[model samples]
Target: MASTIRVGVVGCGFYAQNHLNSWHELRREGADLTAVCDVDPAKAEAAGGNFGVPHYTDAAKMLDAEKLDVVDIVTRHETHRPLAELAIGKGVAAIVQKPFATTWDDCVAIVDAADKAGIWLAVHENFRFQTPMRHVKRVIDSGAIGRPTWARINFRTGYDIYKTQPYFYNEERLAIADVGIHVIDLARFFLGEVAHISCETQRRNPKVRAEETATMMLRHESDAVSVVECTYGARKLPDPFPETLLEIEGETGAIVVGIGLRMSVTSNGQVSEESIGSPLRSWTSEPWHASQEGAFNACQHFLDCLKRGVPADTSGEDNLKTFALVDAAYKAAEEKRAVEPENWRRKA
Candidate 1:
């Protein structure tokens, strides 16, 4: 109920830097970034200095002492559930990064906790908020792509993630669990809930313990089928082979988004393409901070929802479907059979 929301950010890892930058942007606009936390004191201190805020090595200490209105978690995929539960338990709203949790049970627990506590809990699935993608969604909703029957989402980036974050090579955190999850979420964003899925994954780079590439086929309840491809091992090419592309086909027309960092739509025999500037490109690069602009936009939305007492666009409940699809795709690939999205269960 304060004039400005107070925020605390946890985890000072690679992506957390972007969160800090985002929070700083909010601070300039009257929000208060009271504190920051990370397991590594040095990282936390560094982020705090960068954002001109207090630093803590313990998230609980920060949450208890700072009177935070919202807690942003940009930690590893596995840590989301616990961090989110802690935030909700403290009566603070939460915004978490993608791959919500490693398991469905953990995700459900987070959702349940937030619901029981009556606090806003959002998954920072920023790709859905990208300008080009938002435009694509508008076009789809406008019936420009009438009743989309098929689509393909590709994240064939040549970005050398391993070189930047060697931990990504760990088998437990493969490209499928990291990068592919984004495309899976994107597919669900454009289409609807997937009823069934079939997937195939491979580790093209033997050096990495996790799969470097994966392909998945999804069947939506609407009978729409689409292919999604993900790769961390995509070779760098002069023509930007490393890109995110989405091609959607409907009853009347088709649309493609992120075509050369922009959006293009064709409806009723008319075609139009325009460049929607990259949200990430506006940020000044500090090590481990790439897309502060995008992160800021996402964080702002979360804060705005908390202030307005409105449901988040990417709430934890909505993210369960995306998490379910990721789990189903892995299972389908492992078992060499189709996996029903609704049937995905977390391991005990």
Candidate 2:
């Protein structure tokens, strides 16, 4: 194994810039960002110029030309399967951004391809890596919250997200598929695997083409229950646009995370207050630091995992659990019944 990992990043759009910045920052940590690619020439050129790396307009071309150990697929969900398959065919490890793909079948296809080829694959599921969420998980792991029984995970905001990604306005599946997926993953992170899920969807924004809000209830395999909520149509003061807030109650204690990244914990009749927030980075800004820092942390995790020859925390197979909840939530809303999430049956 090489001491330095060579990386090629596809999709240099709005969010991929964070991935670029992160990889560039990790050069000191043994990441060699050797190449970048985007269908748009301008995006490719800009990213290349910014990061001082070769850029290509075609992902296949970039993969063929670069001596890359990994390819980061930061493209749209619809592009994930093909990009991942391309990387896997070339024997390069892949890290895809979430929704994973447009549907469960597509997500599974990509995972299947990776598995058959024995290529390392992971989804850039960053929410759980955010500072506040990490803090909450640490507290839970320390047994301060003592087996979480009930919880609510929410990411609601009225901020115009369409400003950066205008395509969000026309997605056939918006809320749960876009932002809610992260919150649902958080619910599973705090509790455990879901036994079933029921959901309600709302198209509160009259101008939007799809449901802009979703409220999902998950019954964990452990019998614990969680209410997962997300929306882009919220009208509120000081909206936590990019923040996830939740309340987790266990047998012995509870953890409540509120606005401003403030967390309150009650363990064994004792209470404590904590401000758990991500530190702003040179390439990160306020209101989005948590998300930006999370992207960085997630990339770092992928690099470390690749170096150690270990499956990522959010490996492709593992992310299917999170993506399954997404598919089930949409189905449960449409069918007006609880739906069991479809699990991946690995090929033997």
Candidate 3:
């Protein structure tokens, strides 16, 4: 209950830089980034030097030493559960990045621990927070698109994503778990909770160990059916890398978020179009700005929710639903059938 929330970031690797920058920018909004930690000494030192904060190579040492109100776990999926548990165990709140954990049990354990500790827990699911997606949600909520019926949410790219994070080549669960999870969450955000899901997965890229492409069909609880597609192996002329193009049809109207972030909506027989691209912040760059803006917006949302003492939109419990789709999608593809996403709370 300090005037300013003191934050300690656990990872300082590639994507962690965005979290560090976002925390620094949130200082005016009452975020005090106190410390940074990474197993790699060089990464830790560089982030600390750039951000003017103390650095540590050990997360336990940093967690023990820093009087942090919240710990942001920006590490890989494998480390998420333990890192989150570590922070929650010490009575500090936690915000972990996507793909909550490697498995459903791990995700459940972290949630259970946080619930018992009575601390805030959220997953940084950024897609729903992106500017364009937010606008799409607003249009749906405004009744501009009355009762979204059928939709296609897609994230396809031929961009060389492995250039930055080459470890993707070795991941056993690649496409669906990596980028598809975001689109899947977006589907749930705009539409509603899915009643059942059927998916098809392919290992299109010979270089990768697992499926690099995933196409899922969802039957929402609203009786709406949606097709969600995501792949890193798309080969096309207008490669919309890192952009999620969508088409949503409602009872009265429709919305289409096309390439270059152009959003067209037809409501009540009136058609309108606008460029709803993510604005570039001082600390952000082109192309990646869309995703970086999402990360920043998501962090801001989490910080605000923490201050209000409320569960975030992507709270551990809610994200478990999204995570469940990930598990069900993989199973659906393997079994060649439609599967109902397991309600984690019911199983708990």
Question: Of the candidates shown, which would achieve the greatest lDDT relative to the real structure?
Answer: 3
TM agreement with the true structure for every prediction: 0.92, 0.98, 0.98
Off by over 4 Å in 3: 345-348
Superposition error at 40 for model 2 (Å): 0.4
Question: By TM-score, highest first, what's the ranking?
Answer: 3, 2, 1
Pairs in steric clash, model 3: none
- For 1-348, candidate 3 gives per-residue lDDT tens digits of 445889999999989989999999999988899999999999999999999999999988998888999999999999999899999999999999999999998999999999999989999999999999999999999999799999999999999999999999999999999999999999999999999999999999999999999999999999999999999999996888778999999999999999999999999999999999999989999778999999999989988888778899999999999999999999999999999996654754
The lDDT of model 3 is 0.94
* Candidate 2 lDDT by residue in tens digits, 1-348: 557989999999999989999999999999999999999999999999999999999999998888999999999998999999999999999999998998888988998899899999999999999989999999999999799999999999998898998998789999988899899889888898998999999998878899999999999989999999999988998998688999999999999999998999999989999899889989999888889999999999999999988999999988999998888888899999999885643442
lDDT of each: 0.79, 0.92, 0.94
Report the poorest 10 consecutive residues by lDDT, candidate 2: 339-348
Query: What is the clash count for each candidate, in the order shown?
Result: 0, 0, 0
Instruction: Please give, for residues 212-233, the per-residue lDDT of candidate 1 as tens digits.
Output: 8899999988999999998877
Model 3 has how many clashing residue pairs?
0
